[model samples]
Target: MFSSSVHYWLEFYVGAYHALKRGYSNMDVLVALGTNAAYFYSVYIIVKALTSDTFEGQDLFETSSMLVSFILLGKYLEVVAKGKTSDALSKLTELAPETAVLLTLEKDGSVISEVEISTQLLQRNDFIKIVPGEKVPVDGVVIKGQSHVNESMITGEARPIAKKPGDKVIGGTVNDNGFIIVKATHVGSETALSQIVQLVEAAQLARAPVQRLADKISRFFVPTVVVAAFLTWLGWFIPGQLHLYPQQWIPKAMDSFELALQFGISVLVVACPCALGLATPTAVMVATGKGASLGVLIKGGNALEKAHKIKTIIFDKTGTLTKGKPSVVQTKTFSKIPLLELCDLTASAEANSEHPLSKAIVEYTKKLREQYGSPSDHMMDSKDFEVHPGAGVSANVEGKLVLVGNKRLMQEFEAPMSSEVEEYMSEMEDLARTCVLVAIDRVICGALAVSDPLKPEAGRVISHLSSMGITSIMVTGDNWATAKSIAKQVGISTVFAEIDPVGKAEKTQGLAVAMVGDGVNDSPALAAADVGMAIGAGTDVAIEAADIVLMKSSLVDVITAIDLSRKTLAKIRLNYVWALGYNVLGMPIAAGVLFPFTGIRLPPWLAGACMAASSVSVVCSSLLLQLYKKPLHVEDVPIPAGPGDGGSNLV
Candidate 1:
């Protein structure tokens, strides 16, 4: 009994005294002193009973017991609630498999055998075989065979990606089709999945700006309450000692000493700083987890808090709004061949080229064959292929010399160019499209107009942002003509074109700007903006510098991020109002402020229950944010009446 009281209970008393010595106070000190007062006073009553064979008033051993028990219960519930806020992160960590099947090559290296080994034992350059319906154990490139891998969990992309020889596969992704041999390139912590998990853990531990406010308020809250409790005791006890108290003002069951002690203890027991401390962090925790589930990763509380107030969102033109890769948007042919035939001839000639534009033309032709029909059942292979570096490519296709490239390639080959072809190429260049002219037997046959097309959702998302009264601006390092043409198509009116990376950052200074980009050049601007959002498909430099990452790589998630932030901030404000209001009204009532009127007074045990209830109420309110659902469309957001009328009704 002595150890329990001296060791366990004494810690609270010591902490309370320590806080007092520091010229501040805390909830622990108030709780410890409040319960100890009731217990020590009761001990005096017990000694009086033993000496005089008569006890006066009540002995409150039960009051102290209930106070400790209720507060302990509240603490346990708070821990449990905080655990639930991180469930999404737990689910992500569970995606990786523990073991992998190592592939051992037989003599002559023709046949291979499988040996099951722990994932930790795998290393770079080691070969592994993944069967259909199994997870890829580590990041690797396919060395043999072909299959489809589901990378939805890692990238938030729903469709399965076709994995062929030389294609890279991420660890933890599921193989959905044929078996494949993979040579490991990255292992263990070096994989993308591991990095994402670490980022989320760090983000959850970070504090927001509002949490600092709550901390400042709590530093003064406990000290003020302790003084209030002392004043309440003095006010009643002094008047009663002078025999000036009215009968109706005092409780029926007690005299001045009993009444004073009851009111003073109640005042200390009912005051709660735990509720105020939990208001912001708990809401941020749940909101971050909710964002991960929607493919939007919020790096920390500062990003979440700032994202809610973003007035202007600046988007980088090239990779953020567009597909970030050249595609065959328009194709025209002058010869007797059809459009699809011209594409097939161009694709066959450009298939062996390593240039991005050439690869785009080849890919477009492959898609055309799948959708419609191939012009030739078997594509003729090109011979004596030569790349002219910025000019184009030339090869002998089926004994006929075929050259596919820009006008420079056509001019060097001395290919015949008609007035009609010149007009066609000029029209494409004016629209910011790269022209890939196809020539067979030194005759200009056709041209493929390649360009980076805007993402299907970009225009709609920009229009939606405009409707929300939030200004959307386009910032890019590209030429003004190209930037203006892309901006007009995407519904953006403000364009900051021909600006360098450093200039992009300077343009956003002193504004609540959200810079969205996906390139190495965008890193400086991303770091300078109030909130940096990077596309998942972006370079490593951009992603590392960003505050938020969009795993879906869709412009719609920008809207989702902003909307989620507003909703999360709303929950935080709601929590603060509840906690502050509860303390403001309950503290005075517990101090017997109503005793002189209706003769109402809170007992010590009742005050303890109210304190526990207040903390639980704040936590429960934060948990309601888990019910948040993203809006389906812009129309789902309620429109305001005027321009300056407080932001959108997103909540």
Candidate 2:
């Protein structure tokens, strides 16, 4: 289980030891003596191979040494850089629950007691007693009592959430005081804490893919250097110089060729793409680090690549585009269809529904019932109900045919809408209120306006994108007018309204969409887009589907994300300039370009040493990423509420 660089360095050093043991006499001065012999032999071979055909330079000894040294140096630097970038993920994952308060079954009335157990054994529905200042062992619903829990490790929020019976608690969150019993709902890998660890692991494994232009240029450049080095040796082999060898001209030509070969080998040793190989990942590591500090999660290299191209954005109506706080505005009592009866019908149909819209309707009905006294006596059965997916519902309620849906449901029954009602509906609908048209028997009763507020920073985030020359758009399951109104308010001009999951993906196609959302419904859209950004805190599905997951879950991270991409791209370009510039100067020198005038050719040892310097320079350039601090401007959207909005519940 050694990290890549460890294996790279270990093999290099171990091979160096073996190479010296076989070639040199002294085992005690293994490293230094081997290095000298390798260099001297390389110089002999390079010059000899260059000056004469009767070449006598031993091939393997010097060549193997040079190749290993440069590679080991490159690898050592990489390991250190990766450790720095890995800090955020490592620190977050360390917050896992260490132990749990285990409960064992007893015969008489299930005697309750606690024992310590491994965190892995915690499961859904298992009741665990939590005390103040202890970390909650797993994600669960509180079964008894209440307490405030600090959840900064998972959500990146400093504020603590007050948890009561049925309130969800995440594993690793500290229970700040008060005894409470928690019924585990999600455990182990299903927990939010575990998911964050998994996502980070997956992102690390992904190949930091190369830019096409850079890859092509490097591919040809490496071989060209190889070819040029060969030609430098040929100049020495062509014969006709002041005694290149000792004694005879024939043997002298061979010695001259050997000297040329040494210099040529030095060129090869110096020519490693060590710095070039690191250009992208170094910048990427810094970019992701910048994002992490701002509570933004750039999942991988591809996310860093595609975020610059987004033009149009999409959203889901009930949750993503709205505040997710749908409330009742208007309700009418029909003599035929009573207000209480309508409430009963809608509430019963939505009893098992978890959608935010459905929850709002049910809660609104309960509040009305609590205010206006008991409902009229009417027979109702929980068994005789069915939920319609897109539109509203049709159910047999006390043998009476009741149909409650959107405007389309009224249109299907041919119920005429009055101008006064129509005008009220039209005005509210224009403002992005979801108007549900209700009906009982053959008559249109009245309309209900349930409005979900716009997210606070939605408008500002879109405006920022436009300034960056990136166009912003939204796709949502909301009605056309509702979607249009939200788009207008958010500074988004284009939107695909009334789109389901499949439609969301199709809309994502054509435009280089960066879908930003934080709910399960947005999962498909996240997978479909050129890049998906899951914004919001601790959303499991959003974390999974998106290329980038927002740790803070704010709309402002959208701007930060794009900004990081631009910055990282610039860094990579700078690294390329340096790598290419170094080679441009060094390559010709290795080719005997200065031969006749200077009368001094580079020895193999000196050339290899110079090559190592270039690679080290590249390594130093990559380390500059540590200085890239995330921008200081972080934005937060205040949660909205109005006169009629429900009071915040403890959770």
Number of clashes recorded per candidate: 0, 29
lDDT of 2 by residue, 1-651 (tens): 337645553554565466456652121122233244455665666786899986554554644455556555556676666776677667766676678887654555263677888888777778888889898888888877889999776665678888999688888789998888888888878876666666555554554555555656655655565566566566555543555433342233345655566556555545545566666766676566556645666777777877766666665544454556677766655446667767887666556566565677778888877777765332256544555656666656566556666667667667677776577677766766766766656466666667676666666666667777787777776677777776776667777776667777777776677787776767888898888888655367766898887765566777777777767777777878776666677666765566556655554545556655655665567667556543323334544445332211000
Identify the leading candidate in terms of TM-score: 1
Return the number of clashes found in candidate 2: 29
> What TM-score does each of the candidates earn?
0.81, 0.78
TM-score of 2: 0.78
Tens digit per residue, CA lDDT, model 1, 246-335? 856665545687788888888888885767877888888878877887778889999999999999999987778877777777778888
Whole-model lDDT, model 2: 0.64
Q: Ten-residue segment with the worst summed lDDT in candidate 1?
A: 642-651
